[model samples]
Target: MNNVKNLNKWANAHTYLSLDLVRIALGVFLFMKGISFITNIQYLQDLISPIDKIGGGMFLIHYIAPAHMVGGIMIAFGLLTRWAIIAQLPILIGAIIVNFMGEMHSQNLLLAILILGICVFFLFYGSGKHSADYYFKMQQ
Candidate 1:
């Protein structure tokens, strides 16, 4: 019981800094992914092209590129973090779906899940103490 208490105290103490780092890393990753999509739009389009016949595919194609770029930037800067996370969630889920539907390797699924998990973590943690949100709060 004492050990558990000590562990909990340690975790609480480190959680903020750990999560802030996570937010920054996740932001960088998503931003890079966005840039990849922008630079290689045709290749990505080919990947998603199969789903184009589906009802929502058109919508996804239309919005996903911008979402990645804009959402990625927002997340990286911790600007409107929650909303940025929300915007990116659908894109990540869509990628998961596409990978599954394409019969890609299990590792792809794991990677997507890991990335999604990080996004969800930031969603709940609110960008921690090292974000634009924190800076804005300080100014106000």
Candidate 2:
């Protein structure tokens, strides 16, 4: 009976924290992707210029790098998570579209889809209990 109760508790905890895990994973991915852009700016810019020109030459390529880094950090730390996810949506959507239109790399498409889904999940479910948002709320 005690073992059964412990198992149930463990399951419940896992279920409860799943959103946090998702947020963490998405954060890491976004951060790495942003870092890649920053490290390979000229290469990415060359690759992305055609798409950028198609959209009237806005700073989408230049802008998303910092947004991704900031949003990723916020989401990873569970600080202002919903806001961060909202900020990231444009980049995520743009990525999906670019991947769809470009070389159509299967792995890239799959990753973009997964990240978009995770962003959507956090948009609705919030940062969960294991976050800086929760900590701040508790302090109040």
Candidate 3:
């Protein structure tokens, strides 16, 4: 009986209720910031200074923003945990390299670091059973 209980616990270990709050918050924040890029264009343009125009920024706003927002919402809902984490990974990496490591002001670097750290957390822990990954894997 004990063995069976342990197995159940292990299988259920990844549930959303068991997931980390930090990861959730990260997704929410990233989603909002991404949306802000399009919604508040002037603010974002001001932030991404030194580039005559961030071609990359346009890429992110158009291609990556929607993905990040969708992934983030899924992550927040514990829907598609692994996919969300994986999708957000490139955004974080580029963020760290572009804004923080670049010639931008200190605030930009700090924001990049904050976002990067949360993305890294999700990359590692996942949404657990609370995520769609749990059910999908079982079907497999």
Candidate 4:
């Protein structure tokens, strides 16, 4: 669509190294969280236990870890970066909700909020000039 193309043009024109670094850091953080979830799945289950009572929590248990791992990699490399961030959106929103519905750990709440903010920013910002997306676009 013309709107999407124009948005991409605006985002690309406003690229910054600092923003790229932030994107990379956010990706690494998500990846690390995924790794942690895999290593200690019980923790993930416990976090989602409230949602389990409402149904389909078991499905999320299987979905979140792998999504984070793969999505994080794509985000880090700026390969389909927006799609990767979009995949992360649901998980992050659920994380924030879970924090409120349950015991509400300050650390978890803060981290989720920060990551969500960064993801939202990237949703609009796209990958910068230093990303795989830009490189591929240039190749075409």
Taken over the whole model, the C-alpha lDDT of each candidate is: 0.74, 0.77, 0.64, 0.91
Q: How many clashes (backbone N, Cα, C below 3 Å) per candidate?
A: 0, 0, 7, 0
User: Which residue runs of candidate 3 sit more than 4 Å off their true CA positions?
Assistant: 1-18, 46-57, 100-102, 135-140
Kindly list the per-residue Cα lDDT of model 1 for residues 1-140, writing each as its tens digit. 57634543454455676676777778777778778877887867876765666767657766877787787777878788878989988888977888867758588688789999988876665656567766786799
Measured on C-alpha atoms, candidate 1 has an lDDT of 0.74
**lDDT head-to-head 2 vs 3, winner:** 2
What does candidate 4's lDDT look like per residue over 8-118, in tens digits?
Answer: 899888888899999998888889999999999999999998778889987898899999999988989999999999999999999999998989899999989999999
* Model 3: lDDT to the true structure: 0.64
Task: Report the C-alpha displacement of residue 6, candidate 1, in angstroms.
Answer: 24
Kindly report which residue stretches of model 2 are placed more than 4 angstroms away from their true locations once superposed. 1-15, 55-58
Worst 10 residues of 4 by lDDT: 1-10
Per-candidate TM vs. native?
0.80, 0.81, 0.66, 0.96
Error of 1 at 38 (Å): 1.1
TM-score of 2: 0.81
Query: In candidate 1, which residue ranges exceed 4 Å CA deviation?
Result: 1-15, 56-58
Query: Higher-TM-score candidate among 2 and 4?
Result: 4
Can you give the lDDT of residue 4 in candidate 2?
A: 39
Ranking by TM-score: 4, 2, 1, 3
Kindly list the per-residue Cα lDDT of model 2 for residues 75-124, writing each as its tens digit: 99989887899998877787778776666767877877888888987776
